[model samples]
Structures are given as C-alpha cells and as structure tokens.
Target: MRIRATVATVTAAALSAALAVTALAAPAAGAEQDDTPTQIKNIEVNQNRDYTVVVEAARKVKFPISALVHDPSGIKSVSFSLQHGATEAEVDGRIAQVGPSRCVKVDESWSKCEAVMIADPYTNVRSNALAGAWGINIVAVDGEGNVTREDYMPLARIKRKTHLSLADATPEPVKKGKNLTVKARMIVASWEKHKDVPLIGHQVLLQFRQGASGPFKTLKKVRTDRNGWATATVQATVDGQYRYDFAGTSLTQARSGLADFVDVK
Candidate 1:
C-alpha cells in the first residue's frame, strides 16, 4: 500500500506541472496582435497645407510639425526627418532628423505628437543643395515594438527670399502715346553673405495701373540683364503707376515692387 501511494503522488504532481505550463503558454483575454504596425495620420507642418520655407539669410529658421498616430498596442514614439532627395543614395548625406517628441494621449489607441525643424542654411545647406522642395519623413513605434516608417512625403518648399525694386520710370512727365522706359532690378538673399545679390536671366513683369488704388495690369515681361536690370519700353497712355512684379521661380519667392507714379502730359 505504501509503494502504491508514492506512485500516485508522483503522477498527480506531473499532471499539475503540465497543466500549469499549458496555462502559461496561452494568450490572455482581450489581447491584441503584437505585429500590428503603428499608423500615422493628419500630418501638418506649421498649420499650412503647402508650407513654403523661405530662407531669408544665413540664420536659423524654426518651424513646428505635428501628426496624429494610432496603434492598437499604444504609441511609444514618433520621429521626424527632413530630406531633399527621394532615394536612399540621394539622401544618405543630406538628411536632418528631429528626435522623438512628447506625445499627448488622445485615447487608449491614439496620440498626438509634435516636433520642430530648424533649417540653417549657413550650416546645413548641403542637405538637398539648400533650395527647392523638401520632404518630411516619419517613423512611429508602438508599445509592442512594432514600427512603421514613411518616407519622402511632401512637407515644405525651401526657396530663397527675393525682392523686386522699380528703380525708375522716365520720363516723369511724358506726352501721351510716347515711349516711356521703366527700369527695375531683381535681387535675392545670399545665404553666405547675408546680403542681397543680383538674380540675372530671370523674367520680370512690367505692370501698370490707371490710378493709385486699382488692380494693376501686366504690360510686358522682360528678362533681367547681366546687371540684374530689367527694362521695358511702353507707350505712356495716361497718368498712372508703374511697377515690376516677379511671379517667382523654383528657387526664388514672388515679390512685387512699390509702384512709381508718372504724370501724363
């Protein structure tokens, strides 16, 4: 009877150990999939749909970026990167990254994250040649270690700040129906010198309005010369204002010069 009791106790202990192992291996109730990736949504940079970054000088310019993220396992981090090119080979040496920012919890499954990008042309202009359109890259991680990476999304355009100045309109008092010359110059901000430099070989529009307060009409388009000068000769029809307008290009910003009033005799 004693030997039979010892064998029964060993069998019962073995059965209990197997049952405990099975319970430990099973998933808990209401558990989520550990492989689900975090989702990114509603990304906005500086609250502008088409945010244009104009580098005025050799200084640093800062802007805010925000996004909404969702994950079943909860959000761990959200990061941002500013890139110039599309492929990895193109952006390998020209990328700017902002580390994970504080995220505000919206719910059990969603969070809002915010970050800032500082564009310094004097220091980091090598990133994408320091001009034209740039993209924003995003990477999100969930509580379960699942990650989601999005690359090369349209975020902002980096352009050089420019100005148009109407130098002169001569003759000041000219007879109606006579040829009048309008002179202008186009200059852009230089990142290295922090000064205005000539922007040559660019188109500038000569615009005229009948009065001091009215819609102006484009008279003609003239290209800037080697001296950054754009000149147009038009018939002086009446007493009005003349100005130069730059519609902007891929690397420069649009600018309208102050009007120069002329009296018709």
Candidate 2:
C-alpha cells in the first residue's frame, strides 16, 4: 500500500519569481526525476522573525510525515533544524514510518508538520503554532537516501503578515434538486495589489459533493478570467455535508483560505 507520486519538473526560478524580487536561480541540472523537490518557503508570517519551515519530499518518493514527533505506523522519523538571517529555527515533527514497499500512507502531499518544540531536540507537537518569524536556511536528512535525499526550505519567501484585504471564495449550499453557485472576489486589497499572489489569474474549477462517505462527486468546474474574478454554477444535491473545492492549483481551495462549507436545505 505504499503510495507513489509522479514528480513534475517545476522550475525553482518560477517559484523564486513568485517570491519578492530576487536574482533568478538557474534550474538545477538533471532530468525531471533526477532533480530534488523545490524548497517551499514558510516566510509569509514574519519576514525577519519567527516562521514555519516545510521540507519537501522527492518527486519520485512519497512519505507520510508527522508535523510533530510521534510514530505513525507507516512512515519513518525525519527531523531537522535551521538558522538563517536573523532567525533561529527549531522544528519538532516525527516522520511517518514507511513500510518496505515505501508507499505514501498519508493522503495529502503538502502539510504544515505538527511536531513542535521550543527547542529542536525534543517533542513539541503543535503543527501550526510558530514561535518567531526569523528567516533561515534549513537542511533535512532522512534514512532512505534512495527515496529522499536532504532538502531545504528557503527563508526569503516568508510574508511577515497576510494582506488584510485579499479576496476569498464561498459556495452556496447544494440542494437535492438544485445546483450550486461558486463565487470569488478580492476583499483585501484592490485587484492590482494582488498581482504578486498566484490565485488571481488561475483558471479555477468549483467542486462539491455529499454522501454517506465514499467517492465524492465532481459537481462543477470553471475558469477565473474576468477582472480578478471567477464563478461557477452546478446542480446542488441533498447530501448532508457540502464542500466546495478548487479545480487545479493546490493552494487555491482551502476551507479556510480558498474553499467553503454549506449546509443543504
């Protein structure tokens, strides 16, 4: 039951550009599979102070990770510490033990690891609470070098604070006989101010479903092309729980950040 994920070759330069203006990095030399996963940044919280650090997995390998330090049945223990710029990083997460087959036990690929520590050597499992926003360089080491070599989470991309005026989305409750309508907008800053954020030009698809608990339905999908706006309409159903999902990009549809929950009538 080891989960294997396809590694896509995304240029680090592309991600660097998404960050604040900086000199572009030459793509690491290698075929897609040979290259390591990009170092994702946790810099949005504090540009110069406390921040979260995320170490990415190899494109070819899938491993379950604990945000903190606890042994999940199927993943191995992975840990690291960082010190960069003005900040010092102390992480405390346990890696899920991977069986010999090395499949991905965890369903999702990206997560804010839960293991926390006021210091790095011990257990401090609060996956989301971060102490300081200081930026720094990180080095991650794992036992299975065959599957995952060491990786880094960059310090430059941290956002000291979130934009209060950024736009968000919500979906109408789906009915047994009716459809659903998905909506999007920029509530924080003007359409122009959000240019740096990737959600703006994204061609989005709205997805929803409800049932006893099984394969969910793909209710609807659409594109966001008009002035920093997108919308979708779908027939709603009489399911007890309703969830609105985004189409393509991973970061767009968050129940907290980009998605919505609605109760059916």
Candidate 3:
C-alpha cells in the first residue's frame, strides 16, 4: 500500500507540471496569431453599408475583402485604400494615390485626391504625414442612405508610429474666434525610428487640431530636428478648445497620441 500511494503521488505531480506548461504555451501561440498581419490583395465595396476607417500607425495592414464582407444589397463587404498623408487614401485596400487631395479615385467613390478623413482634410500640403500624429479619414456614406457607390475604407487597423503626449499637456486654452501659436519642448532621452523610414534629420511630425472633432490639422507645423526637438503653430478659426500632439514615426517613451488641450472660450 505504501508503494502504491507513492506512485500515485508522482503521477499526479507529473500531470500537474504538464498542464502548467501547456497553459503557458497556449497563450503565446495565440498572441502571435493575433499580431500577425492577414494577407489579402484588394479592397472592393458597394453602397448601403457604411465603412469604418481606422488609422493607428504607418504600416499597411492587409485584410481580405471577403473575410468579413458579405456580397449583399447593403454591401456587407468592403475594401480599403491607404495613403499615409499623401492625397489619395488607400483604395479598396492597395491603390496608392499621390496627386491631389480631393479624390482618392473619382472612378465612383468620393475621395480627396490626397486627403485624411478626419485629420487635415487638406493633404495637398501634407509632407511626411505618416511620420507624426495625424488623423486618418474614410469615405463612408456621403449622403447617408442606400446609394450605389464604391465604398472607401472598408476596414481599418488603428496603428500609430508616434507616442502622443498626455491630454491637457499643451499651452493654456484660448476663447473662441481666435488663433494659436502652439509650442513645446520634448526632451529626447533617446531617439526613435519609424516603419516609414523618414530622412536622417526628420524625427517627429508635429500636428494641431481645434476641438476634439477637428481633423488632425497642421498650420505651419515644424518637423523635429537632429536633437529630437520640434515646434508648430496652429491657427483656429472657430474653436472652443485647441490641442496639439508631438508624434514620432517610432514609439514615444511617454506614450502614443499624447495631447494637451486649451479652451478657446
């Protein structure tokens, strides 16, 4: 009886160890799969169903137009065309637009030649858009009804290269009907890199916007110099609160999308 009990105890111990090992291994495998980008070639969409555009970073996240898009009357399916701050945004999912900012493609879908859905809405002057804190826009229902149109931004992956500062970190707020000359100093504890691989001297993309709903606007914004320093001045026309963000192509140690707000009223 003594020997039998001892054997049972050893068996139980081995089983426990195996179970623990498996538990740890399972999560790691799942995480890798989640982070891995999906492979798809094109983006195509029809009217009726609205498109949700999300831009978090600079890399082009691949998505299969058929994975979640069902071919139906309301366009249960869609695609994306992404252009990091260049005029034409991504089309269905892979066409690169680099001309104007009014139409991603006038083939049928309404788009800016080179436009950000929510950011500047102005891409003609955008340079190094993918390198800083910029907003991305998707062309959803133009009129908000069942219409025959090529869907823009069928899917979105919220990715960003820079780390945003904390909200309320910028200068003080100003009242409405005013403009701003935003500026700040960020200590470059260390340098960061971007997936877009900006030039040698360019380190950060400086941007500003009025209120929370305004496009990630940039008015005379400056790029980060060799010392990892940057500054920008934004002019607001009708603002309640104005804010700006310091963003890099690489992750900011402080955080991504860090912002400081000021009231205009």
Candidate 4:
C-alpha cells in the first residue's frame, strides 16, 4: 500500500531566497491511463560537504537533491519534502517542501530530476521540537495518474550546528612534575534560544602535543559534568600544548577545541 504525504508549499519569498523556482511542465490534459507505477531511484542529498544536512541560524539554507524517476507511461512530475515527527499529523504543518523543478527527460520512460532542499530555522524548524532526523520524502507522478512515494526515508541525519571550546587550561608555567588541570566545555546551537548552550554528560579527551607541528596524543578521557564542564589533571613533564577533543555523537558534530600552550620550567 502506498501512503500519500501532504506537502505544504514554502513561502514565495523563502523559495526565491533559496533558489530560482522553475515550473516543470506537467503531462498534457486528458492523458491516457497506462497503469504503470512511477519508480524513484538513485536519490541523493548533500550539504556542508557532507551527507548530513546541517542547519544554521539567521537565514534559509539550500542544498541539492537529485533522483531518477522511471515510468513506462512517461514521467509527469517529481518533488521532495521533509518529515520530523512520528506521525504525519504531527509534522504536516512543518513540512519543508523542495520546489519541483530542474527535471530533464532522459528518455521517454525516464527523467532526471534535481531540486533544492531548503532549511529555514525561522520557519521550517522553529524550535527543538522539530529537531533530530528530518526524513527525506520523495513523491513521483506518472502521466497515467499512477503515483509512487518514498515516505520518511532516513537517508541522512539533520543536525544543528555545534561548537566546542577549551575554556581554560591551567598552570601556565608550572614546574616539571607538577599537576596541571585542563578545563573545557561543549555546546550546541539551540533553535529555541537562538544561542549556544552547554551540553552535559558527554565524553571528552585530554590531548597534548610537543610544540606546534606534531599530532596531538590523548593523555586521558573525561566526561562532562552537569554544568557541561570537562576537567582533567595531568602531570607536567615537558614543554608542550594541551587541548580538549570531542568525538561527538550521532546527534552532534565532532569538534576539537583550541590548544593551550604551557611552558614547563
């Protein structure tokens, strides 16, 4: 059984700001019914040099989405959308539609279609309630009125932009063998607050490197506290730089903080 999705149109201004909206010609009126089902294949989505869709603050963002549509009766139109909640009723109003345009007929039975997926923090994702995996929805139609849809397919994860900071690394010019404490904080962009806040109970790595050229070696691993602070102490041995690293999780992006140089006298 094929489930139909209710796709809402994004604002004209938002579409104009995102990309040039072109209207793909639909099949002519009174087209004959061929009983052929449209099939969507080879779908791809990309943004921020990654498969994951990264949403930012301020204005709307656009990314390219491409797919191949096949139907023996001839292709009509193809479009894409986003779904974030468990049920269609929950996410129906939040649907971010990718304007159907830029489709080229490969042959009589196949067409290559490309569209831009728009992410507007202000409109589409107004709050954290719409966070997490925003599934990709593809809808294809054939000239014979036969329809095919891939609903809420988890192609790539949708994540808000995140950042990590090495707030402080103490004992700047400590004597050899003395203990030096390193402090850091991890924060993620909040859609509701519109600011970055500390992310708690996450693992962080304490790393050190000699001078400014070589790779940083992990000294110890520590987890962040309720206050979103990760602290670890290490004995001063040689002159080098210390830093904090977060491998991140499925919900966040991996980040490395700035290294703090400490002179061991």
Mind giving the per-residue lDDT tens digits that candidate 1 earns over 1-265? Answer: 0011111112233344434433444345666546655677888776664677777765667777778999887777777767665544464323354555879999999999888777776666533256776677665666654445665434567778898885589987999999999998888877777777888899988999997888999999999998789999999988899999999977788999988999999
Residue-wise lDDT of candidate 2 within 81-137, one digit each (tens)?
A: 332223112333322222321222233333333222222212221222222232222
Checking candidate 1 for backbone clashes, the offending pairs are: none
In each prediction, how many residue pairs overlap at the backbone (N, C-alpha, C within less than 3 A)? 0, 47, 48, 0
> TM-scores for all candidates?
0.79, 0.29, 0.27, 0.76
| Global Cα RMSD, each model | 14.5, 17.5, 21.6, 6.3
Candidate 1 vs 3: which has more lDDT: 1
TM-score of 1: 0.79
Which of candidates 1 and 2 is the stronger one according to lDDT?
1
lDDT score of model 1?
0.72
- By TM-score rank, best first, the candidates go 1, 4, 2, 3
Please give the range of 10 consecutive residues that has the lowest summed lDDT in model 2. 54-63
Q: Which stretches of candidate 4 lie over 4 Å from their true place?
A: 1-33, 47-50, 57-59, 87-93, 106-108, 143-145
lDDT: the better of candidates 2 and 4: 4
- Model 1 poorest 10 in a row by lDDT: 1-10
Winner by lDDT: 1
The model with the greatest TM-score is 1
